[model samples]
Target: MNLYDLLARGFPADRSRPAFLLGDGGEVSYAELEAGAAQVAGHLLARGVRPGDRVGLQAEKSVEAVTIYLGALKAGAVFLPLNAAYTAAEVDYFVEDAEPAVFVTDPRSFLAEAQAAAPLAQAVPRADDDVASLIYTSGTTGRSKGAMLSHGNLAANAVALHRAWGFTPDDVLLHALPIFHVHGLFVALHCAFLSGAPMVWLPRFDDAQVIAGLARSTVMMGVPTFYSRLLANPQFTRERAQHMRLFISGSAPLLESTFAEFEERTGARILERYGMSEAVIITTNPLDGERIPGSVGYPLPGVELRIGGGEETGVIEIRGPSVFSGYWRMPEKTAEEFTADGFFKTGDVGRRDLDGRVWISGRAKDLIISGGYNVYPKEIELVLDELAGVTESAVVGVPHPDFGEGVVAVVIGAGDEASMIAECRRQLAPYKSPKRIVFVEDLPRNAMGKVQKNLLRDRYTDLFTAG
Candidate 1:
């Protein structure tokens, strides 16, 4: 069945039921949501959008953003949701690379800029064969490449998630993550539509607002940062969260301490899952079985996962119906990303335990090589987290003349440098321990809450100038 058919099915069951609750605007019923999407589809069709044509949406998270996303699906257009926080240069790169037929924006001012530079020669109606959406990877080390996600890929993922998560008509999702990323757009919102669940949309995450919504929401899916912030909130009480059936954490590593604290207070373990822009969602902690902390549970029903290179440390490759077709307009890159047998190389190093729970070590690119030994930052960060008065820490690799790259730990919290260094020495080997520690007020983070290690590298490079 087509993905849009899921929303269509909801119309007849209970059109009057609340379909979406916007932060600024009031609630929209299922009937209203259907009509809005239809109207947006009509608008796109009138503007020459046809099935498979690429439609770009650059907007803040709003009811209109949700409508445009679903409407793009109904119109059979590939919806490319761009981060509203991205700079003009970043936005230009995606538009030029994807060559979208039409660009949709919240503000009228950006139309002229898009029309002038985008690669598509002429405006034309959408066609199913046309590329749908091109999601760009965050270029931490190199230029960002667009991961081309087809309608079929997205539809299959939504259905798979619907079955895996036990999403039902009764499920109400508290949507706060930015719609730009696949986790928010495809996994959360799409799954909600596929299951006919109502969604509560927050423009941006606020601890108080999110906690308030949890009282009414049945399911809440968010990144680890969101959960961390929620855990830090003073108003976060068990009384507020008793109504929520499922609490999900994704997009980044869900710190074990944060997970434990949340469960202690709320009596619900935050289900940690794994996914990237290329595959959407690969594994999730089971709904009924043991929801293990620090592990992204077993692979979903149709998803097949394998560890390659070595048993203890290996690259994660996934083959599934939910996997994207390839990177957009980059055949060579696409070919390099997939293996001989067709498993998409996740570029993440991981290992699976006997119980089938997956543990992500770190990104292959982020692995630090110091004095002929490899050190995973996640290991050091976890150890530092256990140290007294260390609130948060990020371990990164910096240029070293002798070792090629040396490990550096930038920490955030109140503690004597001697104690922090001593703690690392106790927990890690000499090579694995951070060579230099820098105390920072806060680490620079991307929109998704991932530490911008590249920025950290630049910042510290100047601080530790060569003698």
Candidate 2:
């Protein structure tokens, strides 16, 4: 069955239930979602999208935008959602590489492109292994790689999380996360759809909006930034969140301080889970058991997580249906990603406790994920190295209160700090641009000439630490 076939399993049971409650006091019910998505699918086909072809969508979050995603799935087109923050130059690289049949930006464009064809209101049955979506993930290599998520991979993870997270029809998700990322789009939306739950959708995370919605919502999934902001606000009282049954943190590491603080404030424990774009969701701290700080807890059902056994923290390798099949059009790299034992080598350095809980220490990759967005140091360094005053540059993530990791650039050359920052802002997305740029005489290097980022990380450890 196609991923759409699996996704529509619960729509019938709650046809009148709101799938999306827009910030503007409007709602899109489950039935409306199916119908709108069908129209979008037909529109995609009319616009020259075919089975297995990629559909590039970069737009602000809306019910219409999400329907377009479902429509692409129904038409069997790979739904590739680029970050709205990505500049046109950055978009060009992905669009050129993926060669999407249709590139959609606004509601008018989506509707106009699909207007010629009638609604494709039914599921387009697909083989389990057929490609579903191609989401880009930056690796330690600094270049972005598209991970090929299959219908089976998505279905398996959704079903597993439904069971693991204890989702039900009664749950109402207070959704504030962006629709582009896997955490918000795939995990949050899939679990809501599969469980026949309604969503109170906010355009973006505003502390005021979240606190107002918390009384009505039973579940809230967010990055550490969301929780930290809520905790920072004096208005986010325990009574305000009385109706909220669950709070989940992911996409970036959840600080131990935030976790303990949240539990203390809410009288309810916030569950911290671990996952990456290569795999939708892998492990989660249990809902019914100890929601441990720093530990992502046991693997979800059907996910096989193993640490490359060593005395210290080891690389986490997984083999399961939920794991992505390969990287898009990169067969050699895909082959190299797996081990002789057939486990997908996750570059995240983690260790497993005796209780089977998993704790992440660091990333083996040089990618910085700030506010749930992937920022490759190489991408930024490439731009910096091109400047007249720069010989070379190294980028590293330092601790941050709100963004989880703040991007900091250490430059080897003497350039006006403002000029370098402004240049980065011109070339890269706002999230990918370094928050701080430091002029260093030389970067710490090891005997093999590899820049010791760990040393730099230690030196600037308090960059974002509060006084």
Each candidate's clash count: 7, 1
Which candidate's lDDT is highest? Answer: 2
Which digits, one per residue and each the tens of the lDDT, describe model 2 over residues 1-467? 88887888866475988888777778889998888788898887777778999998898887777888999999998999888878898899899889999888896566655666799967677898999999997433557799999999998999999888889988989998888878888999998988888899987889999898887789999987788789989999888887788999887766565687788898878888889888899999998988887789999888888887654566789999899989998999999989887899888777888888998765666567899986767567767777878756788999899999999999887979887899999999999898999998887752212467877887887999859
- Which residue pairs in candidate 1 collide? 48-125, 49-126, 50-126, 51-126, 51-127, 51-128, 78-132
> Which whole-number lDDT from 0 to 100 does residue 208 have in model 1?
87
lDDT of each: 0.79, 0.84
**Sequence-dependent TM-score of model 1:** 0.92
lDDT of prediction 2: 0.84
- Scanning candidate 2 in windows of ten residues, the lowest lDDT window is 443-452
lDDT by residue (tens digit), candidate 1, 140-212: 7678888877656766777778888888888889998888899887888877876777888887899989988
Off by over 4 Å in 2: 12-14, 112-116, 309-312, 366-467
Candidate 2 colliding pairs: 43-114
